[model samples]
Target chain A: MLNIENIDVNYGAIRALVQVSLEVNEGEIVALIGANGAGKSTTLRSISGLVKPQSGKIIFEGKEIHNFPPHKVVEIGISQVPEGRRVFPLMTVLENLELGAFSRKDRAGIKEDINNIFLRFPRLEERKQQPAGTLSGGEQQMLAIGRALMSRPKLLLMDEPSMGLAPMLVQEIFNIVKEINQTGTTILLVEQNARMALSIANRAYVLETGSLAMSGSAKELAENEEVQKAYLGH
Target chain B: MLSNFFVQLMNGIALGSTYALIALGYTMVYGIILLINFAHGEIFMSGAFVGLILVTVFHVHIIIAFLGAMLFCMIMGVIIEKIAYKPLRRSTRLAALISAIGVSIFLSNLANLIFGANPTSYPPTKEILFPVKSFELFAGAQVTNLQILIIATSAILMIILQYFIKNTRIGKAMRATSQDYDTAALMGINVNKIISYTFAIGSSLAAAGGVLVGIYFGVVKYNMGTLVGLKAFTAAVLGGIGSIPGAMFGGIALGIGEMFAVAIGLSSYRDAIAFGILIIVLLVKPTGLFGTEIQKKV
Candidate 1:
């Protein structure tokens, strides 16, 4: 549902993304894998409109969305769970979720969805009244996903959701990602954890220093010897 | 002797109330926009002069005129934010600070042209709405009609303000916006609208304080804002610059401290004490009593 074509992003003198292109179709989890500073995050950021590209276009569904601001991007049914799980530390867990649905007017449905999120992640429900900042790293990651899900986005762009979690929590998150895909919500995920990401993704792109270096089915990429040696630590 | 202390206490409350009112504006504006509106004092002064003209020359009802002055000041505040602030929202806070000072100078000098330098006495008044019914809250205190009015009006205003901030949907948006601008925007909250709302609320409070001062002291001047605004700023800082309730505590504390300092035969040190208390508060409780300690990373 999201198409990006030859996007270029810069931070003043530094070129972050150079002529990069990617796409995530409906009901698919597309993974962008790269090392630190490989432009994976920048690509997602450009798509979300947090970082406007100097060149090229972003099409959500069928409309060009390169000009929209980050908030307006959310309104257009693309929600981003920013890197670092930037949940409002002072707000209650519930408040963070309420903020997730900020662009929607569907009050009762939003409320029901929130309840389902709590049910889906029982730990969050137990600490619902607590400030989000106080949650454990795993719980905070769950909170971040829950918050993103609040918007009921057509496409959820997750940036490194598995960055700092334990192995079991990482698996749990990937399981939830699959469950989310089963519910028909498309996701564009950027990750440094290529092994886990490829395991769950149907299709994947290897982003190397701001440009797409490789693209194939997740199984083929995982089986590729060079990919196995470099990304999978085999 | 006890009556003298009572008199001092009454003066403290009156002075404190004014400080509280202005400080509320400071806190509110600062909280939402993360701005230090140096022009706020001038806004208060401008409101006073506006009220003065309405009452003396325009012959408007004291009540409706009060509303009119506040509304006028509120609009001015919004306009100032639109002109001086909205454009500079993404710029550094220092730039916003300088722009605020520029607006302050503009408003004050404009008032100087309109009202002139001489102090204008609020046309002699027989009390229509006394701020409070004069009574002995305690046996030894002597509360005048004016002091009572100042205390009552301030208390009522504060209560109304508290209710607005705590229970309203707009208030929730304000708190959310104050916490995080980008995040608040992502949540479909219009950040600019909320910032303008903050300016409106703050300016109205200053207008109310200006009118109350006129009714209490029986004189309003173009320069009255300098002293009151500075004290209110001091209170805002003392309480915790971006904290809502901290401003109240700081304002009242500054007021009582100022009055007590003068009462103790240290009238020469009035300004000194206000500034000193502020310095001490900053050095000690930088967050102010009610301010959040979390340093919000923008």
Candidate 2:
């Protein structure tokens, strides 16, 4: 479980996020949907400790992790797949996955997890030795997800996994997210793709210009008026 | 005579090994941080001085003195990282490079003040490395035990270094970070810690190279590493600025090239030979022999 309460974040003097509160229970897929410029990604970054909140707290499990460094946040069981599919381009596809489990200790488990990811993304398995930059966008997204899965995170934070994917690939990526959630790992997904996000989310929050606009069960939020016009294309 | 040729070849190996070691420092640091640690040579020189002072003042065992040089250089390397590098991590490569030059001048002048402008040598010794049997390769042409040791030690260190980079945990982290920094941090790798370790290892290797140069050349003096470090950086650039194996190849090639210049009766141009090769390589293949070719997104 995770709790982010009344967190404020800024970029130097410019404020980025106002007091925003959100929570995700264990075994849940919580989607934060918004248009461009929403503070969704910033919120995820704040939890991951990349953005030091101006004055707010992010509690992962039971510990206060606001002051933790970016690396320490991952060590504490939250893995982030950043937007833009920024895979380590020079590294081999396999090397990228190996870095995912960097702080892990169980050697056998690491190997097993890699095999599982390869099974999920067979295309990656086929091009294991190739440089990641050579991968197609969809394959790179798969690799990004596979790399995060290698971290064995208890809670996965994804920022725009479907950002640049084809329509069919978008559904495939979301299905994979659902599959990952079914395995009992909690996920906090942030996306501009609201219809698909709320389509699969257990609970959803609408982030609008650095503020949490609304929160409800996925079905109810899908029928909400603003959510319909702004995000769902209804 | 054939003897002269064999002697020159042995000397080449000795010089090549030292260059290879120093070049490793340059390439490793450059690979991880994309900044050329120009003061690397000063670090090597400082190692030699530290070892010399320790041996002369305390009468420490030669082995311990060499290792002490390594330890001292390693710590100094970490200190350099803290002061010279970490602050400029997010800055432009040009700034970091200028900072490295600043560090270079600072250390060199500091040593000049403390040790004086006069060149210092090792404490008077009855024996340097044990003089062993000289093997006659040709009539009156011979390889002494010291040259053999220098060549052998350098080759061994290069081999060990190759193994360390290719197959180690921290090595992987270094490689990962070198390839992608933000992603490495996402995996919980302390990127700065890995970089500090790189400098420490590189400086340690340079320390060993310093001691070997001291013994092989039958002298240890301040400012020795200046020429050697410059040549080593040339080697790094020649082989590929950010490639480890490239450094070794570059170092050895420069060494042999320098010796070849001397052998060809152009000893005055010995320094020029290394620089010449670097220029040619950069012009022809900007990414040295072992360097990874990167394509920038248009």
Candidate 3:
């Protein structure tokens, strides 16, 4: 489980996140939905230690990890599938996956996990020797997710997994996310696609500008009138 | 005339091998951090001096001296990165570049203070290693044992380097870091360590080059790095700044070109010819021969 308490993030003169707080319980998919510049990504970035919060603390399983560097954060079992699917363009698919487990030392375990990932995403196996950048957008997104899973993180933070995908591909990616959570890994997903996100999430938080606007069960948030109008495009 | 050409070709290769060695340092560092590392030439100079001391003062074996110089420069390179470039990682590219030049100036001047302005020559190869004998290739195209040694040493180092980058885990991590620094961290790679590793590898190669040059040319001067460093920089740019194979090819090509300039009775314009080729390459193909189109993030 993870707890973020009153975290504030700023980009020089601009306040990106102000007194924002959220929580994710074990074995659940938590969705944080917002429009552009709504601080959803900033929230995920803060938790991942890519950006530091000026105030408050982030506790991961009872340890304060607010000041940890990004690599240290990953070492403590938190992995991020960053936005834009920043896979290493020149590296082969297998190499990218190998680097994902950079902090791990179990050779046998790594080999087995890589095989399991290949089984889950057969397209990746077919292109294991090909450079990652040559993959299609949907394939690259799958590779990104696969790369993150390589780290074997207990807490996976996904930022816009469905951005820039075809609608059908988006559905496939969401299905994969649901399948991943069903296997018992806690997921904190940030999305612009609120309808799809809420459909899969057990609990949801709505972000407006740089503050948390609302929080409730996924069903309640989806059916709420103002939430439907602002986020769901109803 | 044909035999004369062949002899010049061999000489060019021996010289180009050194350039190629130094150029690898430039290309690798630039690939990872996007810094030109102007102090690299000074690192080469330091390597030559270190090798000189080991051979003359400490009385070490030639092979031991070569390896020692590399080890010394590897540590030196990492320290330079920590002191000169690491703190400027978040600053502008210009700031890092200026810091590099500052490091370069500091290093060269330090060498000048220590070694003085006079050029020092290596002991005769016959006394230290082996007799310098010219072996005939054909009619009159001859190659010295020293030329063969230099070229073979450079080739072996390059082969080992290529294998290291291609097959090793740390090497793969290095490639990943070069491609995406932050994303690499997200995968649990300590990028700072990777950068240090890069500096270490690059500086070692430059050191190897320095020792080989000191042995081949029989002279090591305090300020030798200035012009040679600039020439190696030219080679890196000519071969495509960030491409590994490109640096090798560019260095050799520049070396041959310089020799050919001398062969064609334009000896005085040799340096001019090197820079002229760089300008032409930039105008014709700014990315150099093997460079991919650099993506600019918005």
- For lDDT, the strongest prediction is 3
Proportion of native contacts found in each model? 0.39, 0.78, 0.91
Candidate of highest DockQ = 3
What TM-score does each of the candidates earn? 0.91, 0.88, 0.98
Task: Estimate, for each residue in A13-128, the C-alpha lDDT of model 2 and write its tens digit.
Answer: 76778999999999999999988888988898898877789887899889999999888988989998988777888678988898888889899999999999998899999999
lDDT of 3 by residue, A15-115 (tens): 99999989999999999998999999899889988889999999999999999989999999999999989989999999989989998999999999899
How many backbone clashes does every candidate have?
1, 0, 0
List ranges where model 3 is wrong by over 4 Å: B296-298
Lowest-lDDT window of 10 residues in candidate 2 chain A?
A9-18
Task: For candidate 1, give the lDDT.
Answer: 0.84
Show the lowest summed lDDT stretch of 10 residues, model 1 chain B: B125-134
Q: Give per-residue CA lDDT, model 2, range B1-298, as digits (tens).
A: 6778778877787788789999999999988887889999998888788877777787787778888998999999999989988898767789889999999888888888888888777644435446456788668788887777777877887888777766777877888777766667888898878988999999998888887776565566567767889999999988898888889888888888789789989999998888888788878988988887754331
TM-score leaderboard ranking: 3, 1, 2
